[model samples]
Target: MGLLLLLPIVFVSNALVPTQRMTPWLRDLTTWNPISAVTAAARELLGNPNPAASIDAWPMQHPVHATPIWSSDY
Candidate 1:
């Protein structure tokens, strides 16, 4: 039941469609998705390839700062 509920969240968190490729509304959703923040933080820490890093979004531009902000919020 919990997994079912969480499935859509996972899908919308930019795993399926890169935020850059999503429609504007979806892109906005993905931008603030906690998963995106976590992923961005991980990529920054691990030096992994993050395709979205090139985008001009605040989270993408300052992932290290965004992660803590997101974490404290929820």
Candidate 2:
């Protein structure tokens, strides 16, 4: 049930649409999204090209550091 609810959120998050392409408000939303932080951290760890590279958001820039903070909040 939780997974179902979160599925649409994943599409709305930076996972599907690159942060750079979203509106400023949307980009900010995705920037603070825990999923985005996790995805960014994972991409960083896996050596994959980050889709949020073009955005100058702090979370995208320091995903490794953001991951711990994001996790603690949940």
Q: How accurate locally, in lDDT, is each candidate?
A: 0.79, 0.82
Q: How accurate is candidate 1 locally (lDDT)?
A: 0.79
For 1-74, candidate 1 gives per-residue lDDT tens digits of 99998788788785556677678888888887877877877877898878778778898778888878877945
lDDT of 2 by residue, 1-74 (tens): 99999887787677766777678887888888878988888988999998876668788889899889977945
Q: Compute the lDDT for candidate 2.
A: 0.82
Question: What pairs collide in candidate 1?
Answer: none
- For lDDT, the strongest prediction is 2
Against the true structure, candidate 1 reaches a TM-score of: 0.76
RMSD of 2: 1.9
Residue 8 lDDT in candidate 1: 81
Query: What RMSD, rounded to one decimal, does every model reach?
Result: 2.1, 1.9
